[model samples]
Target: MENNKGKSEWVSQQNYSESQSTPYCITRRYGSLTFEETVQNVKNGIKKLGLDLVGEFDVREYLSSDMEKMPRHLILMVCEKETALKLISNDIQMSVLFPCNVTIKEVENNTIIEVSIEDTDSTWSSAKKKEIIEVAKNTKNILKKLLDTIEQQNVKL
Candidate 1:
């Protein structure tokens, strides 16, 4: 992933900043779009990949009431019906992790936008059910493809 300078800024694809409460597997990729463009691109990418865009939240605006001008940040809640069904059927407890999240954030003083996806894998690593494992793997793959779509959207400039 290259920034506008043509310098590679892709730091890590693993959940290197993981904590117990934030075990949700996450991976990020920097793109050539600004904050607003990346946000819209995420929505389009989600639909283009046939994933459900169930919810959206503007974190920046939500916190602006109390804080000063903040960098743009948004979260898109996405899910696949059949995948959700498979996960819950295999393990009802997995319902808590339903509707995976895709986050678009502006960083470097709002000069750069990074897109991240909260994959379903490793989030519920306790599952012993084969069906549940398969669902997680499949969901993660779908989300990875979505990330790729978002990254490749504005290939030049």
Candidate 2:
């Protein structure tokens, strides 16, 4: 890879100082698909969900990372959810849907400030597929609820 560190001003630099945050902008409410389609599906999902697209990458692009091997590929997006809510409740459970690689990184002003869950793979078996659907549905509901809560908090503030 070319010294993309500061050469391409267009691509934001990755900051290693802060804790990695989950990709909250794109909700799996609709459900999960194979790794091959997750990137495109996430792009479409973010648009449909009315969330902002901070940055996204296909599997090939992510593989270029300095890491020895690219584990899973997950389409990343920016979310205004935490901006509204002080924090995401711990009681809320998150689970994998399909068996594929996925990760979430937070970015600010185009720079990746934090990375989370790098190289996670979910196995997609017949039963796992069904479970993944449910997981995705649950994820959608949680995000919707979180957004609603954020809105309510904003209204109160």
Candidate 3:
């Protein structure tokens, strides 16, 4: 019932004067993640990360209806930007993103982890798209560092 568009603005201004920008959600605009197992996979990933992830079947359903499709999962988590960067970079292969169901955007001081079971068919601006990809790469690197730091700390502990 509530509109959730444009919910991806960060509080702090990022240095983007010379930064390459790319529009997110470029590929599939409409699709469905009708498989229950896919949805659970997303759920498990979020939970495993210890994020306060919640299921939004209603929102998913609503959006699916409006867009004429449903994503596998819409996992919402409120974490620091640094933490988000870490999570995105955890897996080197990052195969979790292959399904084309993930949308990681900063949402009003919060990071939105949109996991779709189905693929999307939406198009975005080239600059914005480039920016999104860059963000993903950065996130992966940050996450990798975070993991290494944690592991080192654990060893000390």
Candidate 4:
């Protein structure tokens, strides 16, 4: 698939090698911002996009109690109530994947943001599958926009 410049890429399980079986996740790399700044930008973008900031967990901070050392990493939970309700109303099992997850972690000189997409595989009706795909696609697009906005803002800074 052709990737747009400076945008997060959707990585489905099909994209992985046979040995790997991870679910789909969208990832983007930010080269111009620090971990804190990147997190802030993401928060701002989420609000601008009308998504709720459910919570943010600082992984590194949580692990510090165990004397474990790691680069700055955060997991942000965001969701749109209407979309979530529609999705669940279509498939109750989808509740396990509710409240989308976005991870930001420091890597070398850049910060990597990863957003997990709902698994669309199931024995649901064709129409149900279509609804799930549509919701996932819309969610992915919003995340891509959020990342793009952050990049653009950093460029202007």
Which candidate should be chosen as best, given lDDT against the real structure?
1
**Estimated TM-score per prediction?**
0.77, 0.30, 0.28, 0.71
- Candidate with maximal TM-score: 1
Error of 1 at 100 (Å): 0.2
Cα lDDT of model 1 by residue, 1-157, tens digit = 5324332223222232342135575656464677777777778888898999999888867766544546677888998899888888888888898788787776655566767777567876678778887888888888888877776787777
Total residue pair clashes for candidate 3 = 24
Tens-place lDDT per residue, model 4, 1-157, is 6534542223221222321235455456666677777778888888999999998888768755443335567888888999789788888887777687777776542334433333333212334577887877777788668767776666653
Off by over 4 Å in 1: 1-23
Query: For model 4, what is the C-alpha lDDT against the true structure?
Result: 0.64
lDDT of 2 by residue, 1-157 (tens): 4654422322334442323334423222111233334344444544565555665555436544543333344445444344213112221222222112224333343223122322112221223344444544444553444323322222333
Model 4 per-residue lDDT at 56: 81
Q: lDDT of all the models against the reference? A: 0.72, 0.35, 0.34, 0.64
| C-alpha lDDT (0 to 100) for residue 122 of candidate 1 | 80
Q: Where does candidate 3 stray beyond 4 Å?
A: 1-22, 25-34, 54-57, 63-157
C-alpha RMSD in Å of predicted model 2 compared with the true structure: 15.3
lDDT by residue for model 3 (1-157), tens: 6765543222234432222234432211111222343334444544454444422434444445344223233433323344344334554343333322333222222222222221111221122345445545544443233222322222333
lDDT: worst 10-residue window of model 2? 117-126
Worst 10 residues of 1 by lDDT: 11-20
**Clashing residue pairs in candidate 2 (N, C-alpha, C atoms within 3 angstroms):** 72-101, 73-101, 99-122, 99-123
Sorted by lDDT (best first), the order is: 1, 4, 2, 3
